[model samples]
Target: MSDASLHNVTHENEAQFGDYFALLKPRVMTLVVFTAFVGLLAAPVSVHPFVGFTAILFIALGGGASGALNMWYDADIDAVMRRTKKRPIPAGKVTADEAKAFGIALSGISVVMLGLATNWYAAGLLAFTIFFYVVIYTMWLKRWTPQNIVIGGAAGAFPPMIGWLAATGSMSIEAVLMFTLIFMWTPPHFWALALFMRNDYDDAEVPMLTVTHGRRATRNHILGYTVLLAVLAIATGFTSIGGIFYLTVAIVLNAQFLWGAIKIWRRDEDASEVDNFVVERKFFKLSLLYLFAHFGAILLEAGLTRYGIEVL
Candidate 1:
């Protein structure tokens, strides 16, 4: 390969600070940080403020590290997908090698610092989360199978577990329930996006469910998962993490989510195209709120329980 193609730093397309930050995928990191923070706060035991802060900071770094490594490996498909073509690497603002090095260094620092600040359990989970995202999800599953999001979702689900472990120094049923909630939510959330952006995956040859199974099958899958997710979300209400507040939130959010899924399931492909996938887009947006509200309510109940108020 030519030197120019070797991701040389001195190249004319020099990287800016923002470009490097973009490589960390700050948007996704926001969700990771928030959910993890909630998980830490919702644990049965209390954490010192400084220790909690350090743990969350390191967790965010681990999440960012995962994002950087994902970009490094997925730069090719990212370059071809219109939605991702503007990412740092494909846009020529950052080099793949730079991202890889940054990710590895951040991964090591984050995991070691978290272990020192919190415990080995949280650190071990964080390390595995990073590795799963970079290796299992990005490198292996994404390009190889239509079930990529279903299996790769585990990487995203681990943050709350890590956070819970960070606070209490051990795992609990509550933490596992939190992890399960995110795990189940991931499929329908992503598949909704895929329904509208199916062409992008097709053009990039990424083997997303929508590309392999067709929109009808994808729609049916969304409804099926949404049904299962509703059961899981409501069942969580009985867990230690759930309170009356969270149960109410879960019921309302799941109802709206199920309604959206039903609408998508009922829509014909011809009608969806004519309507510009309006229902799918709405469902996609709602899925974002669905996860946040559920986690936020959990945090709220945790706060209430701290003050001696009885929650569910």
Candidate 2:
């Protein structure tokens, strides 16, 4: 209504937009969107271009909203942990109230938009993904249990299945196997990071594997999950989506993964001192690539299929 009031309103609007987008957790959203896109495209049916775009957009938005909610609820731990310290809420780019409100709004909008653009099944899965991440994983499991990542991995592993359903309005065994590969992959990936960043979890009073069971146990767990992941990763080769390209990628990646796991397995994390865990940190980074490259190969294989190259 007046000049000072108008300026304040404009600033608030700008801040709100920034926080809303922050709720989308763009970095995490990128991975979700990319994998979801790949899954949608690789499916047996064709999705209209516009429909495909909209499904991926909402799926990414759902991911971001979950991240925002995580940041909102974990603001205390985020501030204490080095890895999460710079998130919107903890870094003060967005207030806790702003992030909470923003995350909830986007959560609703993304689910609703996805249902309209695709099918209710996809939208329902997206809704469950958000609830599981925000409520079950972030709020409950992370604080209460060392097996947090083990069970909570389901949230991160859902994007591809959501994409598959978005394309076909049904879930297939191929989608489930893709889900299985990522589910089995999650604990080892995250526990490797925890092996190195033990202090972060310790400082936050979170019962991460590194904190609750000790590094020796965590390393053994990593080796175990790596074996399970290796088996599933390779077995996927025989499934419908598997091709020569996918199988090749799986073998090479799993070999390197096994080598890294064996390295972690053989070495004693506690023997050399806390600093010796840097090897674990490097392995964690590699695990990130292990996922990206595996999915990228699937994309390549799908492309070959579309062109009728038939490299299966």
Candidate 3:
């Protein structure tokens, strides 16, 4: 659909509460919440259970607000993209104006509540995160540059830092390491998806690496980023938050991730299509586990330290 046609789209059915919830992009919100939670727990300072719960709640609200705003602004391209076509706005279940108001209201509520419940430092980070994702990434970089995910990934990486701040009311190297892990992991994770779904990006006119540079270059970039990601992930294991459990998880996961990236790098489009892009698909799935496992292991390390059973 043309952007004009998309703007004119109207719903024949009434918007349900589920439709509004879907606008939050709950699947993506899961990762944001998990990483943020891990960050909060891993901090040196202990937080009151209620205070911790409140902080995470407001942070998740901020993440949901960002999602709504992103859907509102990108509804035009989202309407054409197969992967995104069923979203609340693109599916005509919700109007862009509704999403915009919803997002703005949620953003304000989240920021203010977080500041009242936790510290302003964490609240400030949450506010910037919403702005970066909605304005910097979704609005400008996504359409204008192929390096969109590269620079825009910063928005996703901030949650952990915010979580750390909520607990400690300050930043630390441990928090920065947590942020770095996600920052470095984002490119290879999304690029692998782009390789398989290149057509969606092409049709939508989004300047993804696969759309702008072709699968070969995309594969190369994936391999390159995976190498760097491996370094960062493993190095994080030696930081204050790291323990034997996290180190073991990092080494094993990085090896698997690098191997998958190599498989993707070696395959051509013809071979990929003939095999249904299995390498890329597996790489993408592994990328998801790679991140979750790393954070889970970090949380485990923190739990052990509390019991005076630190694994060094």
Give the clash count for each candidate: 1, 1, 0
After superposition, which runs of candidate 3 have C-alpha atoms over 4 Å from their true positions? 1-12
> Per-residue alpha-carbon lDDT of model 3 for 149-202, expressed as tens digits?
998999999999999999988889999988888888899999999988868988
TM-scores of the models, in the given order?
0.95, 0.92, 0.95
Per-residue accuracy of model 2 over 1-312 as CA lDDT, tens digit each: 788777765343345566557666787888798889878987888899999999999999999989988988989998999988867677667788878888899999999999999999999999999999999999899999999999999999999999999999999998898788788989999988887776998999999998998988998999999999999988887776888888898999899999999889888846536667767877888898989988888778778877789743
- Which residue segments of model 1 deviate by more than 4 Å? 1-12
Model 2 TM-score, 2 decimals: 0.92
List all candidate RMSDs to the true structure. Answer: 2.6, 2.8, 4.1
lDDT of 1 by residue, 214-235 (tens): 8889999999999999999999
Poorly placed runs, candidate 2 (over 4 Å): 1-20, 270-276
Candidate 3: deviation at residue 249, Å? 0.4
Cα distance off (Å), candidate 1, residue 136: 0.9
| Pairs of colliding residues, candidate 2 | 24-64
User: How does residue 94 of candidate 3 score in lDDT?
Assistant: 91
Question: How does candidate 3 fare on TM-score?
Answer: 0.95
Clash-forming residue pairs, model 3 = none
